[model samples]
Target: MSLSKIKAPLALAALSLVMLTGCGKSSSQTSKKQEFSWSTSAEISTIDMSKASDTVSFDQLRNTMEGLYRTGKNGKLMPGLATSSTVSKDGKTYTFTLRKSRWSDGSKVTAKDFVYSWRRTVNPKTASEYAYLFEGIKNATAITAGKKPLSSLGVKAVGDYKLVVTLDRRIPYFKSLMAFALFFPQSEKAVKKYGSKYGTASKYMLYNGPFVQKGWTGSNLSWKMVKNKYYWDKKNVKIQQIDWSVQKTPSTAYNLYQSNKLDALSLDSSQTKQLSKKAGFQLINNGGTAYLQYNLQNDENLANVNIRRAISMAIDRSGLCSTLGGNNQPAKTFTSKGVMYVGNSEYTSGIAKSSEAYNKYRKSEAKKLFEKGLAELGKSSITVSIMADDTDSGKKTVEALQSELTQTLGKIKVETTTVPFKTRMARREEGKFDIMVSTWIADFNDAISFLDLLTSNNSRNYGKWSNSEYDKLIAASKTTSSSSDRVKDLQQAEAILLKDEGITPIYYISTAYLIRPEIKNVYNDNLGGWQFKYASVK
Candidate 1:
């Protein structure tokens, strides 16, 4: 299952204040006209991807909104709405020439459109959960904190087709960041006209990418993305429309796929074996890590390190993975393998030393840790609340963990809480629960995206886990020039984090989608989950 489906409620709730916001099925009434239609397990919680904090809706919106740049099949960056760009000698400034583009409404897309959108997102009043994505952008942090005015933000529109951006430092993966939904340009007219209703549904906003949304009820179970006539690359863009519906049941999605009513669907653990033999069944590796996060700030027993370590040791990741599904490997690091690169070098390949002492898999060792923790805290029992979305895998994992904890950790009571994707996200931000199941998808191909959340101030820190030394290493590595030196620094930082048991590492998630052979140029990246540009159904 996608992380967004599990954590959608809480993530959406986190953006509830400034937000204006905003799934699938198949039908076969077809002609020779090339059209691509797919179904997600759940409907998108919001359509305003720029302000979105979750990954699921962001992936869909990436198909609708063109960013400053986009990623190609090779993982290299390519121009999206920007026709060309120039970088200054200092590597701190970038100037982009925007392609002639128009909104679905026939209004010309202008430089001011980007300027207004960037300012609105970073505005302190907006309270965008994704505001931190603009860290390197000059004065963005200060402007978002209300220490400076919006005019001081590092972006400026030189003309109707020119955009100039200044950064605090040179970012290697900066273009990939621009390809994400958080950086997609928004219109000032749309925001003001809809005011609080912006991005609520298909009609709430305009599109500039290959597809424009239509026939969405905002709160309903269905929506569609029609080909955008005003898109800059309309000539090469295929797929006239994409029809989507929401089916929360894994069985239903599988049945639809089998009946040829749906072109693609995800497999549950039960369906994995049976469907692996079917034609067009292939696994798309998406470097994602799934794990349980402890709300250390709330629970007294969980606030102690030994107890947290004990819980980590008790989890049988191998068994849990078997129960969940195939095409997944147990994770030992927060940033999974193939997640980031250091000049064609795997970042953690050399530095993550394999030692049984820190491996955290022994049940006997876990019991010892739990007993020691109890003695220190003077408590006989520990009750932990495990929060998850209301889904099959969510329920299964929670049950498995509960059983493991009860059997391994003496006198432990594991309570379970299940809610919709949006509500769970709200509870996570307010620190309303104890331990929860969660995953972080990379916003950019950088280890810092994973490591920075443990910093004390990140609002995304649901666990309230903190380590000053880890923060120092992550900060230093970001500015370091030598690739080898930076990799070592990151590895050292991961060592400290794992030793501290900041979060339990489960397994890196891989995406499983069944696509028609005729579908061309559909690409996904570790940064944005997926992008639909260059895709054609023929």
Candidate 2:
């Protein structure tokens, strides 16, 4: 799903406001019967995998349409559309064996569907936001750049059941990538039938996964996903339906959960403080990092390394984690914990102590750096605007940062701009803010998923920060034949990024949520959020 939706890491400010506004609201169960129900603070953007970039759309895409593989419990990859696959010795080619399956529209699913979908996503005219994920595929980059035809792409259907793929390099995590939404197949006939509005309404799309969405107009705060009778493994689908409501206030959603209206609910700081001891309270370590992204292209002041470093060190991260209180931990490096590993050793654990210390809070040192930075810029004062989503936690984060900036740098002024989740991301891409809080969720299980975003050429490198040595490290990691060398290259690259303080590391997020004790079989993938395909109500 939308691994990038900020992960509900923080909750709203006024519990009283939610209680008052939601006072007379009845449980969702009062109006309709459903096996499971939940709420999201953010809204779903699109169901089309090619256009969808947020977590909500990813979640919806996983349920209504399937990829080559599916994520099972504990984030393990399981067979979905493809029953099995084989890879060449050098890892440049893959061949998948398709299982017998039918789309909701009663047409048999075929290998050609995957080829058409992939070609459509990378086609320059289509302009899918996630097409960069196909970089290693032959001609994918050229096709996206308008230099080659989509026909030149390396994927082909060897008859109706066999799908072949060729890559430019060894992709160790390709299987995991195949499980992501960007790689999901689409029906050519359906795309041609719906034209430009294929994913805007429930009726315009076809379902091949566990559920079929109904009654969604693409903007409503509520919707339903009914079990797809045509799903290949329908016999194993335990839940008949899932109901979703978009609720921004944490207390309001918690109330819905308490009344048996919802099967699960996300907790804010206040809610977690009161309920962490209760049964069925679960903490989800999503392995995502939230950080401060500098507008390297627009803000001349932000280009000064000393100014960025001063700002990075001013905040009290340990105290911040204590106040926020949902198993949150200060980020010591760019790549989060439990994400990258070789055997039992974590990548960050290898960071030199001096390099790792840059992430800690040091008020006095920051004050000194700020004075020196002011001298270097020859400016008496500066104002910075911090942009983030319009959620309870975002408000709190801004307040904390503003407070810290004032305490550490008396000459600087701090301002905050908040908006809806989708709008925040859009503004970020347009480079409209001085500084913005951005979250990176793992696209696959590899460390490179987090490392590749800032490599100068990537469109997602909104900050416009560049370092040749760091780029070389990443490039070497990708092309080299040695596993040990790749890991070492990544280790060196992270150290370099941290030393430069390219982005200020805040903390790694853990989703603190409440679930009904009787609910069973719900699964969380490598990215945060649940997959309800196997969920059931006791």
Candidate 3:
């Protein structure tokens, strides 16, 4: 699923933000450390893997749950609950050999756990937002659409420790997708015991990963990740506990970091400039894009191609990046760089070079288009409002866009409303805004993660933009067996989306942070979420 709806601030690290103090120490000394204090800008929404659609919740889930596979350093697939797997010659079937593991409650983790979780997620009654990710699995789409029984969904257990999964077609990133939180195993007994209360709080959920979450109420901003003694790989887990807190304001977070209360802090634009020379300052280029999603179904002006193009072209992306500071760069396409490649060359490079007219700042052309659009709509002026998060960076982003649109598109009035992250997401889901400021952090290392969001039938397609040709190309990309043909289809679809200004590309996000020197072995999954399983205090 897409990470979150708010700006990148809510898109903080995927795992716990590790922090520590002290000089280099021996492995033995590090192994004895008790706890590490960490901080994030957003609170956990829900830990239910099936229902989670945001980064913060998924990050926490990654800490406390284990799937068939775990994403290790550099996006490599590591053994989790499954120890090995064999694929059929036709590439439509997979059989996995499981490991002997136990959940925090001391119940054996078996293949039945995976079967139960997969069925629950795809069941129409469950209403999982991420059920669409299972589209390629056999009967998954039909099951999610309520056209098939849950038992027909192609996953089953063989005995106690073997799992068999059948797919309708080959998914190129199938193994990587298995590492995502949505694929984590869920205990039927726990779900039955808690029923509606399942995953609502730490006490109601079962954990099989390196840590067990505690102290998190449904709405609290503080929690703890205590090491799980029942984890199969417990011997390799070093840290005893992780203290997690939320600090939305950059200044407050930075203050805590300075006072040794926090081990890391995500910097704001101004703080990034002021702390570039600090010893532990680092810029994290998360494969994420922040853009503008127009409500095409609800707003008449935004539905017009000319008006959407006008709003897109009027803004100076480079200037906006400068105003916001940090290392953010103007986005040339919806997909960020370093995600996928079309034969050794980055996929987005060719598309960006070809989209100069649409991406470049052209105030005069934008003004002409805006006037023409207004004339065609039989209106002298139009009023529009942008919805964004109430955080400092979110406010700056909308304010800058408002200035550019009103200045370049004369007779157009642009208003801005900034709400808390959760409220803004609710409004966008309800289709209650003219323009919504949105951000997406890829769930995996693939361009499809971003491009799939604009498809006409996508649940995440908040704008409701429709293009038959674009949808066809996207569908073709998935079915074609040839790698080159798939690339061509995706490229053409992205080109169409850009030419029509379906969504205005803003900038690629690069967050800055300060980490103490004593933290070691921490690594980010290729998608940019950090993993603390192997982390140690040194």
Candidate 4:
């Protein structure tokens, strides 16, 4: 399975938001097209589902590996290895019928493949960043916590073609979550055969998805994906090959596009302004939220809501939007707008009113809050470190924030630290900084994908921010059968989070890309990742 499915939810969530906004970046074409080359700003992290976390690896994996279900041509959930699934009356049990399929090496894909894959991921030793996504599965939490054995994970392969999964509760987004790469089955034989070195290179992994990575060194800036003959639906896989290059510089990618060496190009803030007037210029709403997380574990002051609110209020979100480019918008809530819809209204728009003050630039109020917070802390001055990605855009963004905060908030000395994406992620996971600049693409399309991070016990809650009332509201939304009522509960949860300044919302992402007219069926998912499964180059 393409590991990028981990991040696919972020891009996939855009499908709902984009359709509502009518800002889709693609148009369809029927002409047969073939052999396309692409570029990425970041490098792949890993193909191993147990370890893959970043968007690049997820994007690569989404195409190279097959999941139980795959996002189809129209962004609809479509069956892949599973012929179909049946849901029980209560919606807590799912029985999947596996299709007759073979791995790239010709071994039949059995139900045990899924059983083994899920067990391996939730096993304490595997240390999967995505293990948290398995919370709804019965015994999944216990297995990951090392309290239960793998066999207790509540998933059973009834027979070669039948698999039954019992979840602890109803998950409205369970189907979409299953379609993600993290839920895809790994060939047990292939995994154990490669063992420690599995997923480290293209050669070590087996393929059942539409394509398989070819010539991938596991850390190369260049590689290829060729149509996998072993794919059960390979006949409909019109595009036989995809070429890839990792280019962080937009100008370099633009030059490559001009030279016909690249089929698509992503524009930077500068490029967006320069090329947006021309045809094929797309500014896609990715339904992604970028924000700042305070590491309450790093400092006592970080735990103070007053300090967080002051810092959040000092942000000039409108300025940040223009500076960041790509048609980014100042975010009004932690959850990306359009992530959920209730009665033709957006989930973000329907949230409870709070003194949380979303995106209002109030330097005086921020200064007052900072002063009050300092008094409460009984401190004269506090030094804070800002950890951010080392990408050009990331650097610029952090610098912009640092400048804004330093200029507005008194006595708050700022130290800026920049590192590669992986290193930064490690730091975030370890809770090693005072504040961190981060963006989350939806793990699955829902407000919870964003709000869930604020829960005190969530593994991804690096900040250590917690509130019981907020947790209860979110916890209730999970089991609520009424969609409208659930939305109301989620709205209150988001309001409580913002009112407490649990996180500083910055902006929602918009994917800006330059596409050649010949590239067809190119769709960007809600989470800010691209789907190239149905893409073709004429």
Top model number, lDDT: 3
Residues 232-323 of candidate 1 have per-residue lDDT tens digits of 89987777777766555667766665565665566667777777877656665555567778888778888888898888889888888778
lDDT of all predictions = 0.69, 0.74, 0.77, 0.73
Give the 10-residue window scoring lowest on summed lDDT in candidate 2. 11-20
The RMSD of every model to the true structure, in order and in angstroms, is 4.0, 3.7, 3.5, 4.5
- Runs with alpha carbons beyond 4 Å of true place in candidate 3: 1-32, 342-346, 349-356
Per-model TM-score versus the true fold: 0.92, 0.93, 0.93, 0.91
What lDDT does model 1 reach?
A: 0.69
Give candidate 4's error at residue 231 in angstroms.
0.7
Displacement of residue 17 (Cα, Å) in model 2 is 21
Total backbone clashes of candidate 2, pairs 3 or more residues apart or in separate chains = 5
Q: Which stretches of candidate 2 lie over 4 Å from their true place?
A: 1-3, 7-34, 342-346
True-vs-predicted CA distance for residue 93, candidate 3, Å? 0.6
lDDT of 4 by residue, 1-538 (tens): 1111115232121111111111112123223547777656555667887787766677767788877887653245777888888999999899999988888898898899899999999987998766877888999999898998899997899989999999999987888787778888889999989989899888989977888888778777777888888888877777877777666566777776666556677677788889888777877766577778898876998888888888888999889878767777887787766565421355656665664473467999999999999999999878888877666566777788889889999798888987755576667677788897777666555667777767888767778888999999988888788888888888788888888888887877676778777877777765555676676666
